[model samples]
Target: MLGARAWLGRVLLLPRAGEETRMAQSPAPIPCQPTTCSSSMGHKDWMDKCVCLLTAFSEHMRRVPVALPEMVHAFSAQQQTLKQIVICGDRQAKDTKALVRCVHSVYIPNKVLILADGDPLSFLSCQLPFLSTLRRLEDQATAYVCENQACSMPITDPCELRKLLHP
Candidate 1:
């Protein structure tokens, strides 16, 4: 999603080690050399240089330049406003199917929706890092909406789910 101007700036600002070495020797500009071209280099040398460049670029783009805690803090900050919905039930139950269908019909931006048929506790703990505690499903089909570490009352009906989502 980089703009053309930003991309051009990166291309221009990229440090050229060969250019730097040549510049330090003399003030006069040197003619372009074919030996500097990748096509003119040996296949093994070209491949090695390509790998080095890719590794350096990827390292530069990583969010954590130093430590794991910094990366976790950055990720948490990015997800602070995220809203989550968990639909829990037996997978083959009619009520669970109805709830899934109802949920799919609605669209909410930045909302993380999970359909859990197995152990709800394990699923919630793994997917939702901000939730300290999760309530167990009481019915054959149920749903919960959580935001800012707070959860709404468990809903058992699909119609109630639609209302809660739209409201």
Candidate 2:
């Protein structure tokens, strides 16, 4: 069996309908750059594609077991304080993804995101009192930024959400 990265290289080189003929005529490159798949490509059977990908990955993992890699970030924060962002709203709301991305960009160290549908805060807040007030503002997707149980006012706009995470 090939190593995970090499196997992935070959799998990625699989040609699409139109490219099949051209790809077969020439050899694939020795090195392949990683690529991201967009959901907008109009492939209707994404779930099936996901299943196939997962199955292949699982088979590879069963044989190799584990792969260790060390990563270093020079600009990473040295602080230990946890910055938690709690978002409560419709999970499928388009803006929800943007809100999550905003949280990721600002905090590099010790960050946690708690995503919930509606207000499940009554029970959860008992343990983390800071989240007691987390809820969707105006029935729209809302974000709350908290540190050490102290939280900011609900943010309804993407720009406002990013500012809260940065400041």
lDDT of each: 0.51, 0.50
Q: Give the TM-score (vs. native) of candidate 1.
A: 0.45
Q: Clashes in model 2: which pairs?
A: none
Candidate 1, residues 1-167, lDDT tens digits: the string is: 22111112112222135445433432222211111222222233533443444344444335433323322332342333445677767778898889888878887644666666556367554544433344336656788886655778888888999999888
- The TM-score measured for candidate 2 stands at 0.46
Error of 1 at 5 (Å): 24
* Residue 72 displacement (Å), model 2: 12
